[model samples]
Target chain A: MSETTIGGIAGRMPKFIRRADPAVVTAFACIVLLLFLGSLYSRSFLSPEYLLQQLKVASFLGVIATGMMLVILLGQIDLSVPWSVAVGAMMAAAAAAYGPVGAALAIPFGICCGIMIGIVNGIGVAYLRIPSMIVTLATNAVAQGLMVVYTGGFSPQDSATGAMRYLATGFAIPGVPNAVIIWAVIGAAMVFVLTRTGFGRSVYGIGNRERAAYLSGIDTRRVVMIAFAVSGGLSAFGGVLLAGYASKAAQSMGDAYLLPSIAAVVLGGTSILGGRGSYLGTVAGVILITLLQSILSVMQMPEAGRQIIYGVVIVAMLLLYGRAPASR
Target chain B: MKDWRYWLAEQRGTLLALAIFIVMFAIYTANHPAGFTANVVQTASNKGVLLAFVAMAQTLVVITAGIDLSVGMIFTLTNCLASWLVIGTGLETAFGVVAVLGTGLLCGAINGAIVIYGRLQPIVATIATGAVYFGIALLLRPFPGGSVNEDLADALTGRLFGVVPASLVALFAVVLIVWVPFSRSVLGRAAYAAGSSETAAYMSGVPIRRGKFAAYALAGLLAAIGGLFLTFFTYTGDAAYASGNAYTLFSIAAVVLGGVSLFGGKGSAIGAIFGALAFRTIGDLLFVFDFDPLWQPLFQGVILLIAVSLGAFALFRVRNRLEWFL
Candidate 1:
C-alpha cells in the first residue's frame, strides 16, 4: 500500500482512481460532492460567476498552501505562516505610505520581510537543528511582536497601494480575476520546480530519508533552508494579496488563513510526513476547502460548527491516505 | 555508569527546572511592591498553576514522542463546559466536575485512537481534534457568560489556612495522585521505550500502543484539570481562541525549559510544572521591572529562541554529520 506512492515520478499516476494518487482522486471526488451539496442550497453555487468568485477566494489560500506544500514536501512545516502573512501585508501597506519609489518597493519590501523571517526559520531548522515546528513558532511570535510594536496597539493605518488593489480584484482578463492569474502562474512554477528541477528531487529525498540524502552529497541543510524561505515568501505574498483584496491591513488578518491553508494542503493529499504529494491535488484541495467554507457560510453555519467540520475533514483525509506506516 | 550518576541524570532536568523557578520567583518577589507577602504568593500560584497543569498534560504526550495540540483546546473546552455545569448544589457540582473531566477523557481518547489505531501522525491529528474541541467550546459559550459555583471556586483558588496557596496544594496532590502513579507504572516505562526506540520497544514485547494511548488519554484528563482550575479562578468561561493557542504554544516552551525532550523519553512532569511556573514568571517579570508590557512578546520570543538553542549546542558536539539527523 505504501510502496506505490513512493518514488513518484511525474506522470506516473494513471488517470484511473485505483492507480492515481488516491488522496487526489478522493479530494476531487469530495469537491464534486461539495459542489452538488452546495447546488442543493443555491443554484448560484454552480453558476460561472459564483465559481469564479470561489476561485478568487481559493487563490489566497492556494498561494499560502503553495508555501506549506514545499515545507511539507521536505517533511517539515512552517508554523509562522500566520504572522508572516500579517507582516507582509502590514509592511507593504506601510511602505506604500512613502512615495512612488516606496510604492514600487512596497511589494518587494513586504516579500523581503517574509524572506527575512524565512531565513531566520531556515537558520533555526537547518543550522541550529531545532525542530521546524518550534523554530517557526518562535519566529511567528517574533514577527507578531514586531507588528504589534509597529502598530502600537492599533490597526495599521497604511492602506494597500492602488496597484495592489487592482492586482487582487481587477479583471486582468475579460471575466477572469487577476488573482487567479497570479495563482496559476505560481502554481505552474511550483509544478515545474517539483517535477523537473534538481531542487525538487532534493526535497523529496530529504523528506524520505535525511541521512541518506546527506550521504548522497546533497546540501540538505541549504535545501531545507531554501524550502522554508520559499514557504515564507509565498505566505507573505498570500498576505499581500489579501491586503489588496480587502484594500487595507489589519491586526490578526492572517489568523483566518493559517488553519485553512494547512487543512487545504493536507486535504490535497500531501503527506504530513513529507516525501509524497502532487500540486494538482493541492489545487483541488484548496478549491474543496474554499467551496466547503463558502457553502457552510451560505447555510448559515455557526463558527463553531465550521471549525468542527474543518477538523473532521482534515482528520478524515489524513486517515484516508496520510497514515504513518507501522515501521516508522 | 555509577549508581549516583544514573540517579543524578534522571533528576537533573527536574532539579534544573526547580532551580530556574526558584530564581525567577525570588527575583519577582524581591522586586514586587508587595514584597514577599502571602497575597503575592497566592496570586502567583493561582495564575501559574493553570499553565502548570497544562504543561504537565503536554509533558505526558511529549514523553511518548507524540504531541497533543488539543491540550489547550481541551483546557478551554472543559472550562466552558465547567462554567455551564459546575454550579448550584454540592451534589450537582460534583457531577458537573465529573462530567467535565469525562468529556476531556473522551476527547483525548478520540485523539489517541485516531493517532494510534488509525496511524495518523500525532501533530496533524491533534490539530484537527483541537479544532473540534475549540468548536465545541465556542458553541457552549458563544458569548462567554456562564458562572461556576462560587464556594467551590473560592476554596480552590483562594489561599489555604490563610498562608499557603490552595492552588499549590492542589497541584502537589495532583502530582501525587496522577503523575506519580502514572510515572511509576509499567505502562509509563513502556511509553519511554516506545518513544526512544519504537522498533526496539516493539521487539522487546512492550505494549507500545496501550502505553501511548494511556499517555494521550491522561494528557486530556490533566488538561481538563487545568480547565477546571481556570473556571475556579475566573468563575466563568470564555472561549477566547487566541488564549487557547497561546497556552498550547507556551506549554511547549515550558516542556523545553523543563528539559523535556520534544524528541521524547527524557523528562518528568514535576520538571514541567516548574518549567510552566518559570515561564509564567518570565511574563510576570515585565510587570515587576516596569518594562513596557508591550515588550513581553519580543522579550518572550528572544528567550524562547535562546532556550531552544540550548538544545542545539549538542549538535555542535557531533563529530559525524550523520549524527545531526537526530
Candidate 2:
C-alpha cells in the first residue's frame, strides 16, 4: 500500500518536481494562479500597466524581505522591523522638512537610524547572548515609544520631500517604475552577497551551525551583528520608500510590513530556522505575496480574510519545505 | 554542594521573578492614594490575573521549547465566543462556558496537529493559526456588541469576602487544577525531556510528540480561560486587534521575566504568573507617579530590557566563545 502511494505519486509527476526548490515551485504556481484568477475577476487586471504597478508595489516588500532573508539565513530574526521602518520613515520625513541639506540627509539619516537600532539589536544578540526575538522586540517597543513621544500622540506633521516622492512614484526609465529599479539593484546586490561574498557564506555557515562556524574561525559575532544591521537598514529603506509613496509617514506605518516580510522570506523558501534559501525564491515569494494581496483586495475580501490567507500561505509553505532533515 | 543549593540554582529564575513582583507591587501600592487597601489590591489582582493566565498559557508551550503566538488570538476568540454564548440561565451559561473553552481546545489542537503531524515550525504555525483565530474572532464580533452573563461576570471580577479578588482565587484554582497536575504528570516530564533535548528524549523513548501536543492544547485552554476573564471584566467582547497583539507580546515578556528560558526546558507557570503580575505593576507604577501614559511603552520597554539583561549576565561567565551561540 505504501509502495503504491509513493510510486503512484512519483509516476504521475515530472521528476524535476521532486528536486526543484519547493519555494520557487510554490511561488511560481501561486503567481500564475493569482494572475489567472485576477484576469477572470477583471479584464484590466492582466494589463501591462496594472502588472507593472503590482511589481512596483511588490518592490517595497522585496527590499525589506531581502534584509529579512539575510537575518533568517543566519537563524536569527529581527522583530524590530516595524519600528525601524517607522523610525526610518519618520526621521526621513522630519529631516526633509528642513530643506536641501535635510533632503540630502533624509535618506541617509533614516538608514542610519535603522543601522543604529540594528547595532543595538546586534550587541544584545551577539554580545549579551540575548535571544534575537526578545532583544529586537524590546528594541521595537523602545523605538515605538520614542517615536510616539516625538510625535506626541499625533500623526507626524512632516510631509515627504519631492525627491522622496519622485523616487517612490516617478518613472525614471520609460514605462518602468523607480521603485522596481531600486528593488532590482538591491536584489542584485543581495544575490552577489549571498552567492559570491565571504560575508554571505558566513551568514549561511552561522545559520547552519553557529558553534561549528565559530570553531572554524568565522567571526560569528561580527557576522550576526552585520547581518542584523543590514536587516535593520534595509527595513528602514523600505519604510522611506513607503513614506515617499504615501507622501507622508504616519504612526504605525511599519506595523503592517512585519509579518508580510517574514512571510515573503519564508515563502521564498528560506528556512525560518536559517542557513537555507535563495534570493530568487524570495524575489518570487515577494511578488507572489503582493499579487495575492492585490487579487484578494480586488475580490473585495475584508482585511481579516486577507490576513488569514496570508497566514495560511506561510504555514502551508512551511509544511512543504520546513520539515527537511535538521541541518545540525 | 548541598541538594538545596542545586535546587535554588534551578529555581533562581522563579525566585527572582517573585522578588521583583513583590517589590514592584509594594512600591506601586505605597505610592497609591488607596494605600494598599483591599479595593486597591482587588483592582490590581483583577487586572493582573488576565495577563497572569495568558502568561501561564505561554509558559506551557515555552517549557516544551516552542511558542504559541495564537494564545492571544485564542484568548480573543474565546472572549468573543463567551460574550455571545456565556449568558442566560446558570446551566445554559455553564454549557456556553464549556463550549467556548472547547473551541479554544480545538483551536490549540489544530495548532498542535499542524506543528507535529504537519511538521511546521512552531512559530510559523502559530502565527498562521493566530491569524485564523483572529479572523474568526473578527467575524464573531465585527462591531463588538455582545453581553456575557452579567451576574457571573460581576461575581468573578468582584472581590471574595470583600478582601481577596475572586479573579485571584480563580487564578489560584487554575494553577492547582491545570498547572500542578500537568507539571507533575508523565507527559509533563516527557515535555521537559523533549525541550531540553529532543534527540535525547527520542532516544530514551519519551513520548515527545504527545507531550508537545498536550502542551499546545493545554496552552490554548489556558488562553481561553484568560479570555473568559476578559469577558468578565469588560462584560462584553470586542475584537480589538491591538489588544490581542499586545497580550501575545506581553505574555512572552512575562515568561522571560518569570525566568522561564526562551531556549526551553527550564521554568514554571508560577514564575510566569509572577512575571506577569510584576510587568502589570510596572504600568501601575507609572500611573501612580503621574507619568504620562505615553511614557508607559517606553518605560515598559526599558524595564523589560533591563530585566532580560539580568538573564544574559550568566553568559558572560562562559569561557568558550562557541558556548555563546548555545
Best by lDDT: 1
Clashing pairs in 1: none
Instruction: Spell out the clash pairs found in candidate 2.
Output: none
Candidate 1 docking classification: medium
| Residue-pair clash count for candidate 2 | 0
Candidate 1 runs further than 4 Å off? A1-19
Residues B1-326, model 2: lDDT tens digits:
99999999989989999999999999999999979899999899999999999999999999888888889899999999999999999999999999998998898889988987787888778877888889889888988879999999999988888888899999999999999999999889888887899988898889988998999899999999999999999988988877897899889999999999988899999999999999999878999999888888888888877777777778778897667777
- Regions of model 2 farther than 4 Å from truth: A1-20, A326-328, B1-3
Per-model RMSD to reference: 2.2, 4.1
Task: Tell me how far the alpha carbon of residue B19 in candidate 2 is from the true structure, in angstroms, after superposition.
Answer: 0.7
State TM-scores per candidate.
0.97, 0.95
lDDT digits (tens) for residues B1-326 of candidate 1: 89999989998988999999999999999999999999999999999999999999999999999888889999999999999999999999999999999998888899899999999988888988999999999999998889999999999988878999999999999999989999889889888887888889998899999999999999999999999999998988999998898899889989999989898888999899999999999889999999887888888877777888888888878998898986
DockQ of the candidate models in sequence: 0.76, 0.56
lDDT of 2 at B157: 88
